[model samples]
Target: MSVFDSLVGQSEVVERLKSAISSAKGGSSSQKMANSWLLVGPAGSGRSNAAVAFAASLLCSESGCGKCRDCQTVLSGTHIDVERFNPTGLSIKAEEVRELIARSAWSPSVGGWRIVIIEDADRLTESAANALLRTIEEPETHTLWLLCAPTLGDVSVTIRSRCRHLQLRTPSTASIEEFLLSNTSIDSKAAAFAARVSQGHIGRARFIATNQEARSRREEVLSLAFSLTDIDSCFKAASKILDIAQNQAESENSERDSQQMKQLQDAYQGTGRSLISGGARAIKDLERGQRSSTTRSVRDNIDSALLDIATFYRDVLVIQSGGEEILNIDLRTEVNEFAKTSSPKRSIERIEALLEARMNLGRNSAPLSTLEALFCALK
Candidate 1:
């Protein structure tokens, strides 16, 4: 298998990256030939994974053969040539962006492409983005900038318009299921459930399949969506949603803290605490990063779970109209009952209500308040 193979349902993007790496072999390395590339896609749509795979392709002789020493190192993120930046806070700072630009100025030591993959480039603050734009405008030889964002609108037009664009769509259920089953130890039945619940998010699918708690939380949330038939019931469902969101966020944040401790241990080696002020500084920095990550995770999880609920209503509409393809067949019985109770108009209204809440949340409304307002509106 190749690294490209790991990017499920993104054949077009895989082909484009392959072409770029292949052309670079004979073409002028530094003539400013669209060295910057923008990949826009929804959350959980494999945008970051695509950027990493593309970076791996440029790092290898035959386009990232998965078993090659180079590919293995790059995929595991230990490669020296490929640098990945996943900013933890809501904003990527100017100093950090300047550092990334400076790193990109150096030539690859391994006589191959030096790729910089910036995940969530959209989170760059205005100053940080300006710093990055200067580098992209005059990139060094053998350097490639792979910028991943949720949408072009999230990034400055000045930055996005200067780059080659590759947009990724959410994969189909069958594709997600195939990817999960091929990559993990999940059984077919489990893979199907994970794929359905995740709605094409590869990372979420893996989490659901491998973590029983996450799977149970999803089941419970969907059940609440199904049972919310009246005013009191809607409020109850909203409370459950808030609880699930918090629990998932709390658990994930705790796990990340544990992982940070392990990383700290590796860095500290045999040094005593009194002797390692740098280690203490690193821990404080890490905790700040982890806190920001936790906030983002909570918002992300709530939005995805809310979208799933909206999809349930969409499926209810499909079931009511006898559309040939009803989504969320995994909950056919509940969806059918919902279809029976809601007029197509009511179902449509319910979906719009969810979408409005999403917009409100995007505008910086609190998640708990958004959920309550949405549920109250539905009631």
Candidate 2:
């Protein structure tokens, strides 16, 4: 098995990357070997993993044989020449890009090539991206830049034109299920359920399968569709959903935030006492970055809830239309009852309302009011 084995259901992409590595190793002067590459895919589609595998292939003498020390270190993110940046804050600043550009000019420390992987290239600020344009357009022969973004449009045209583009699609449910069963102690039934409900997100499927709390939370989110009876119930549901999302986000970030602040304090301990001398501005900047990260986390949680809610409605529509395969197989009975009482047109309207609510949330509308309006429409 090669390091590319983990890229489940992406055989075509695997082959393409392998061919590029072979051509480069053979000194064939193929166009497949490029200084910069852009890997575009949906979230959880394993774009970062693919990029890492490609980097390992470039560094390994045996071309990513999976057991070599070079492949292992690269995959584990300990290789000196393979630098990865995954922004925890809202955006990648220009300073960060400038530093990366400076690093790109250096020769490899221990490997055949120096690889830089940016997992969230879409979060680059305008100035940050501009700072990268020249470096990406004219990088050293032994330096390769791999950028991962959700879509091609997320990157600027100039950068996109300078790089080779590779696209990955969501893995099939069976592929995800098989991967889960092979890797974890999860039973076949639970694995199948998680795969279906995850909607092609392999990481999410594994998470839901392993964590009972996550499964329970998903059940609660799905139950909202069946509980919408009156206006008061809709409002209550909206509040409950929003509160749950916010609380989850806060809980997930609280420990990390505290640890980061502690690290900052430790770093500044022997410097000075006063705010002006001790670098209070740095703490304030950290706080601001944490706030931005928290906001993003909350929005992401709410968006996930919305997707679950939408999936429930989609199941209703599928059942009403006599479709055989519904996404929520576990909710078949409730889906059938709802389908009996609902018309196809009304179900489509509800789905449309959910989609519009998602769009509004993306546009930075007030979350509570937007969700309340959405639940009201469902009622």
Candidate 3:
């Protein structure tokens, strides 16, 4: 298998990257071999995967022949020369960029190139971006920077202009369904359901296919359409939604938080007294970072729930308009009944309300209040 096999529905991108790899290996003065690259795509569009694959290709003797040890190490993030930066906090600070810059100056430990993959390049603060800009402008001979972001607009013009841009499109529903069925144990029906509901996100489709609890949670969210009858019911619905989102976020982050704390403690362990003079301050900083990470996780979980709610209304609108293709095919009976009582106009308005709630959350509004207002509008 090739390294690009997992990049579903992106044949053109795969071919282009393969050509670049071949050109670089041939020692040709080609534009395809760039010192820095900006990978722009929507979430779950496989930007990070593409970057990893490219890194593997650069490190591999056979140009990304997927079965090699070098390919496996790079893809699994165990390669010494491949450094990955995924911000756990709200932003990437200047200090982090400075450290990366210093690391970039080092020659590769084993491979021909030292690859730095930044998963959320858009999270860099202004100072951090400036620091990164210098490194990108005057990169080391054997250094390659691979930055992934949701869009080109997320990065400053200076950074954008200095890097070669690669764009990835969302996979088709059929492509996702096929991948789910082939790679996972899910049946065709479940695969189709997950694919349609995920709206072309491969990770989400796989999650819904493999996780029964996620499917049940989505069903419960869709069922809320039948529950929003009165003001009190709306408030209850909002509270329930927030509670579910928080629970989901905690479930996802609790184990990670515990592991991070343990690592911090182990790093600061000493023979006697404190590990360092300012051990307490160090621990406090770690805790602060954890809090920021948890806040972002909870907000992300809440936004996902809001998207589910919006998609439910979208299904309702589709049903009301006699559209046969619905995202939530498993909830067709209930959606049909809901559509019978709800007008297309009202369904459209409900979707708008959910979008507004998402926007409010993005602006750091109070989650409970934003959700309550959303459910009230739905009611």
lDDT of 2 by residue, 59-138 (tens): 99988999989999999999999999877666789998999988877899988788999988988888999999988888
- Which candidate would rank higher by lDDT, 1 or 3? 3
Worst 10 residues of 1 by lDDT: 25-34
Scored by CA lDDT, what does every candidate get? 0.81, 0.89, 0.86
Task: Provide the clashing-pair count of each candidate structure.
Answer: 0, 0, 0
Give the number of the best model, judged by TM-score.
3
lDDT of 1 by residue, 176-265 (tens): 999889989989998988887677788888888899877666667777676666877877777788777777888768976898788787
**Model 3 regions lying over 4 Å from their true place:** 270-273, 276-278
Tens-place lDDT per residue, model 3, 1-379, is: 8888789898888887887777777756655488889999888789999999999988999889988998999989899999998887768899998998899889898889999999889888899999899889878989999999989999888899999899999999899999898899989998888988887777888899999999898888777867899999999998988888888878988898889777767776743447466667877888888788788787787887888878878988998998988877777888888899979999999989988898788667998999899899998
Residue 239 error, candidate 1, Å: 3.4
Clash-forming residue pairs, model 3: none
Candidate 2 Cα outliers beyond 4 Å, as residue runs: 30-32, 67-69, 90-95, 269-276
Q: What is the lDDT of residue 166 in candidate 2?
A: 96
